[model samples]
Target: MSAIKVNQIRAKLRQLFEAHLDLSDIGPTDGERENKILSRCLAALAIYIQTGCTEKEAAESVWDGGDDNGIDAAYFDPSDLRVVLVQSKWINKGAGEPEAKDIGAFTKGVRDIIEQDNTGFRAGLHAKFSDIALRLSSPGTSVHLVLVSTGASVLAKHGTSVLTTLLKDLNGDDPEPIASSEAMGLAEVYSGLANDPLLSNVSVDATMLDWSYVATPFPAYFGVIDGLQLKTWWKTHGKALVASNIRHSLGSTEVNNEIKQTATSTPEKFWYFNNGITLVSNEALKAPVGAASRAAGVFSFRGASIVNGAQTVSSLAKVDDDNRLAEVRVPLRVILLKSAPAGFGDEVTRTNNLQNRVEPRDFVAQDPEQRRLRQEMAIEGVDYQFVRSEDSMATATSCELIEVTTALACAAGEPNLAVQLKTGIGRFFVDLSKPPYKAVFNAGVSGARAFNAVVVHREIERWIDKKKTSMTKKSGPAWGALVHGNRVLSAAVFAKYGSGNLSQAIASFGAAFDPAVIEAHCDIVHAKMAAGIEANYPGKFLAVLFKNPSMSKNVFDLACA
Candidate 1:
């Protein structure tokens, strides 16, 4: 079976490569063996899968040659600022993984590119050197090492260890990982080929209430669907019901949980509370109930998929009480694509999910405190953008609402508040009149004070980034606490140094504000926090520990001691 599958994949690769790959640059085809040609084709196939680029583009990305380093192919994905480096190993028997030496050579080649040593590379690689270098030099750029193989097994333990060591060395003390690795064996390759859209021509039988149809911009049926009926479809089709949706059902999110709660509790009011579902199909046929009555009717849909309201459908499926579920009525719109223009189905899907999701912070835009802060900050020659939409400007003078909130949370000298912000900042913006929100943005906070706090918070972040580089593996929980519990540490810094007054501290130190003083305070606070971790919360995960109010407070108290 494995051998047959391997042969199938090889045939597919050969078919694809022959159709799209341009082999002119890899020397005369007469001199190359079939295995060697197939190996190069395998690298191009990996690139095509990774980037969704055209087959020609994937083939053009290949740089395999005698002078080529261990890198067989490389493509910079501009969409995510990721440099995808592929090292493909084609094994005819499909039995073994890449050896440790192969892994080492690949890592060394990647290191060479990262270090900007462009010497001794093949002509094909040299052609793309400048573009690759420019992207690698950009901020937020990351390296993805893809070790692709036709082997049945993945990388060995030692090979994995080598990759891990390389990642660690490349990433160093940076908060964001600079490099990561993945080994794609035959199983992965087979799965990619086998994955097809589920239920492409499914037929759904639904009874819709107050049935109505729109015929102007293409035929569309809109009505309310019974929740129980929707659940039945979910049971039958499962994920196939939403295969056309851009985003799958995100299980048990705060919004989804609320959806489940509302469906099970207040079924009648579900229509008013929910945005409802949008389904697209190639055909729709309605059964005639009566000539005078359009109140309710049975409908049949072919090639149907829920392009929107995936969460609603999923949440309804989770409702256990049939009595309550029977009362639930969900609004649904079915778009018929038979007579629609080209790409109409895609446009409908895109537009249905394109609306900006309302967030807790959006409510704060109406708060007078935000307006006051914005005005005051402008008076101080600083741009405080409290409105979420106006936060696109990347000037040094500008600070967004979230940034101000974080800085104020730290400056409040409350470890709990800082920790809360770290865990989930949404709670602080849940209600503008609430404790967390008012606690951070009350009458006492001035423009200068807010600006100063932001300055201090940014400096602490910078300090933490610098501190990360020096951390050894033995740094252990202390290092974890320092990195993960940064907000709590910020609170500790504020508690010790800026407790008197941020304005006074800024006045004393001037606008340039002493980094040396901040660094010293950070050092003291970090050491104390590390000691607290060892003495109070040994072996505890820093991420969870920092979220605990009491644990965070205890650590903060120790740091400020």
Candidate 2:
């Protein structure tokens, strides 16, 4: 997939060179080029969705001037109901990087459509204008909200921290403002080198373009599939494609149904059927060998909510019947496995991988079945506790993550704490990725299980390292190996932007990033958890920058000093 992204970037650059347009005529900085690249890429996707070809098919749109409403171009996929409405802008460099400015625009546009109940440009795809409008705020819905030149890189340092937090909220960050200033300490890498200027300058560098951000990458065109198959695609029914909902990752209920129907989908794992109403494991829903479990998603890869040098999962619940209340915890986790990839060894296990990384995403692109085979082999040697969640999958919510983590306090196993099991990315976050390190049985666990372990593995640091090592090759080693390689890099800065999708802006920046950065962060985060640490925070790293402007320098660099 990464290769595919590079190819797309390369081809775009090659076309520019082939045209031999006087680079001097385009006297704008790299940020301008980043904007163009993103617009063109999105234009290409719109065209492809409409005509099943590249943007060249709709070349005229590239020149169309956009307005405050923000539709640079549009496309209609005649086959399915997919209508692609593109709204993009070349905002203030990286400062605009998926920050409140863009979100405000998007939210306004969607709300206007809803309020007026106006039929947008009619398209030929299976997508309906009403559904598209509804997707504006609904989770488990499919929408490609493309915002180019809106990411933080466009701005100077102050804006970077602010915008980063804005992106986190869209992908499911905690209610608390992020530690924008706290994460500032990480500005070094994204910051930049001498000749390269600040990371802010190259934040829109097309030089690092890749196709994963594209509608479809090499080997497979997921967008095309969804475009053609979405109307009838049950899996993609309530999904959206943004910085967050990239795949058909649904909420707890959808996952629960998936798990229940396919509890026996794989022998090594079980579906965890609820007491008949939902996907919770009861006596009848028991696993033949292992136990059933529910899962959650690692929406943001940054320190979504950090307080006093600690990662805060959530503080949703407070004091329960069992006396376990207050500090909320995410259920994601990645266990160590002997069989990883060709370059994999014991050095890159799930535990080590999640310690420092954010949402590790490499494993997501693999063959689902093959990845499952690997998980079966690996879990064979590990011990697990078979526990069931009190809720069904569909109704499973943040409360579930809290419940599972709290429930695990009573869990125990033969050797190590029983690794509660779930499936897919949802389960993986709750399973091998989140910190609870216990098993849970609920309806959501079943559906996530159906997606198979690859989805789950993709969120794991070890799996991310395997994918990163296989995909990226550099003389220098990764920052945290299993840690920093799997997550996003954010620093606490002077300001923390409100919430929204940052990918569109980053993509428009002719986006190219070290995959290791995303992976390493996920790994580091997972590693930081002790056998029992909570994932809850009520402070913002960027709050300091806003509360006290005296430390502007520290805020810019994201340094605590």
Candidate 3:
């Protein structure tokens, strides 16, 4: 957490706590009531401030009280396969960092959750038991253990070491694991919530270019935005303005390192050296600046997303408070797409971000099928969201792309392909523009049906993960040796169910199939696959089998045999 606790914002946090936590039913004495209120209030406030989940959800998500086992708030984000365990403290007495015992308690609670022994947890967790159990035991689930305190002190040295060891254990042999400890003190809490009110209305100073016009698809503009103006824009709008960017402003990258260096060292040469920021807005209105000419203009945009130059814009804002941008200016381009067709903004984002060397995941938004799927799912009365970009997937009401892709592939009669896609996304997902990538969307699966399949697919995954957990714990090395081809094992289960016929499996994907039956079938398929892997690729075969698609098909066949 950065050192930025404003007194006014601290008061706001207190006000929020007071409004949400009512201790009328819990404690009789004044001191007891205050303690109860503080505990509950801290839990709710931590969830509300840090996540995009609603305040109502935040309030109900709190699991801190009697027999809490040191857990405050637990949020399971299915979209990202992450389980966030939040521990909160309201230390208004200027107490230093929380004692090591508190950190140890949190770590023990996480271990308990992973082991499925929630006996001492708060009673409120019973209401969210299924969600918590599924996420905690799900395959490849990552943990984010966070401790939010209103005290100014950072974590003690011993507390940090305890958390680091816990993280290492949680990650195990998984390659793409994100396990970490976050200590959000007063400074970060205030900075996060205080800036939202000031960004509602942004007024920029620029000359409207005379030649700006609506060209068939959308309106476009070219202008000079003073460096001071860019700083003001970022300060007011903050990260929200670039929420659709491929990636957020990661501090001091190879590119942003240059941006910070140039913005401060040579502000005059910035315009020539740096490429301009690209923005998409719902509407753009040109304002008169001196005399408007075809060459330059000032424009005010609504509902803006900075699709490019997020790094430069963020870096420039960092150095601007020191009057480094007094004489600096940068060129900017604005595109207004008020009535643009579906997925057009995504296309613009992909095209521009490609130049910035963004990851291939950003290009997922360029597919028009996602928009169509969303529309169709809405019509079917299912609030299923299919997201393409990284930010939308994280913060919006959207499903993970891999989840949808796997579900659809399995439904299209290619369970092996589904398994390959799920396990090998890092190696194969970068080529979404090519044939096999396009086939995931063009498999003739309807949005309503695919959404239903995804639900079933997740349930199946949960069941299989439970089996894996039980087997591994009982005989660690023996089970590990048996499950050499674990990546495609679930797909083999589905492939056997489909009998190499995708249409039949899809048609069977409704409320008719009993969950008990699905779990039973998965058990048989999983066991057979484990044996097949042990007999075939007995020692360390995942590195090669998981690298290519055809290897997954071979495993599926062995499981079927």
Candidate 4:
């Protein structure tokens, strides 16, 4: 059977209630097919909700229905025991809204149904709203009612007075939530976590994945086939999925690349990447990257934030409206650990309560694991734990706190031992895992700096050990979306488990990635690369692949594209 509960039914009913003025025939389909649908829906909702998904995370939200004892289905919010109720009815195409008396009858029927269902399933329901007169006396019933329908909920145009009267009623309105740097909502929480590229698995076991149903920032991408068929499909079809020309946060400001004999005094060397840019004053002959930064003793990642003195502020969020964040510099020292439960947003939002953005500085840096038995491995009915793929991810987010602590320690270059701080979110709560890491781990970054120059790809492989691989599979930004991130971006991998696979996969493609495509990509590079490099095989590192600084795209072809 389905897991749909009375409240979920309530939420579904709520939508129908609001969509139309009446909701009698629109709900509880009497035909065998509709009845089976209702029954299966009820079972599926019940089973999945019990699977550990918060009501909202279960994607069980519906509110177009009315309040009163008429709740059809709904889910509850853990942070606050806010319950959503629903009243739903299936309608065929071209059907009109039910009559006020029918709505009144169903509305009346739901109250009785609640009493009957309540006696068995949720003991709380029987106690909460089984009796109409009792619930009406408790609140205005405005706070609890939801009506759902497949079509319109226009109970009014049909000249229905009762449900219309209910529609006119309210405990009044509350402020609509706004998501800023400070506050978040139920849906935002899951969406934000889903946006994270670092996440790998969410189920109790490692194999089950929580991938996106739609296109998201850190895409939950997968392949249904293998090899050339896959690669062919990927190149032909998948490329559309990948944004080909992202407005690079870093770009060349040069008006044109043209410079004739008259303009050439002595073309000087240039260096640029995600970071800022740099160019030698001389206009003579130019040189390669090895002749530039490595010689100058500087290496950096895609730029964080850099601005002209005129911009006037360091943290752009404070100075500019909208934060002017696209392309602003960010230090690798900064790490964000966001967590939230599932099932808050049945429609517009998600579980984990968009409230995932707790202050980074708020949590005390402690390994949640090391604390030992502060909390249990969840004690709810195990069957009630199944969650939507998106909502199911909260379990793994537990690693954030400790991982951030490790990243900060590495960044600070402080002793490897533990240090603590009282954070803004909760005072005594501590972190427990060590998925810790550092961004700018070496000295080369602080020395050489850039002002402005032609932007190019960052030499990330130079810093991280690009030759190694990882035993674990994961995903996220900076994470390979196809297979788990085995080929990470750097070599200085660090984890509590140690002997880290973190940096090993630097620039390494994913499991679904075809070596032929890689070889072809290399062929493109072979023509423009530093030269003398040919056959690529047997764990060839990205660092050695384009090792030469002299690589350049053909001018004519570059223009055509």
Could you list the CA RMSD of all candidates, in the order they appear?
A: 8.7, 26.7, 12.2, 30.1
* Model 1 regions more than 4 Å off: 1-195, 198-202, 215-217, 226-267, 285-296, 310-327, 350-357, 390-396, 472-475, 503-513, 535-539
Which ten-residue region of model 4 has the weakest summed lDDT? Answer: 447-456
lDDT, candidate 2, 1-561, per-residue tens: 333433344344335322322223233675566556544443443333323333344443332232323344444332222334444433323233344554455444433332223323333211434344434322222223333332232444544444344445323333222112111111211221111211111110011111112122211100001011111112221111111111112222233333322332331222122111000000111122222211211111110111111111111111111112111111221111112234322232222324432232223323243244224323432111112233423211111232232222212111011111211123333334234331322222321222222112233434444644564432112322222112111211101210121112222211332335435544443233211111221122221212222322222222212
Q: Which should have the higher TM-score, number 1 or number 2?
A: 1
**Tens digits of lDDT, candidate 1, 1-561:** 666777888887777665565566555656555666677778887777665555677787877767667888889865345788888888777778878898888887776676445565765566686477557654446678898888845678899898988787666544435577788888877765564334356679998889898998789999999889988988877666777787656543446657778888788899899898999999988777663577887889999999998888877887888788889999989999999998999999998889887877788878887888788778766788777784355355778888888998998877878977754576687667878899988888877788788878888988987887676532345676665678888988888776555765334434557778888999999989998899887745454466568878998899899
Residues 1-561, candidate 4: write the lDDT tens digits: 112223334345233223322224345554454443442243223312222233233333322223333344544322112233444444333234434555565445333332222322244443433343233222112123433333343545543455444333221121111000111112222233233212222111001112111233311212111112112222222112111111111101111111111012221211011111111110112123443332221122121111111011111212222222222321111101121123211211122123333322233224233222112212210111111123332222122333323233322322121111100111112221222212221222110111000000112221222321331321111112111111111111211112222222212212222334333332232232212122222222222111111211121122112
Winner by TM-score: 1
Q: On a 0 to 1 TM-score scale, where does candidate 2 land against the true structure?
A: 0.24
How many residue pairs clash in all the candidates, one count each? 0, 129, 7, 129
How good is model 3 by TM-score? Answer: 0.50
Error of 3 at 176 (Å): 4.5
TM-score, cand. 1 vs. native:
0.63
Per TM-score, what order, best first? 1, 3, 2, 4
Ten contiguous residues minimizing lDDT sum, candidate 1: 192-201
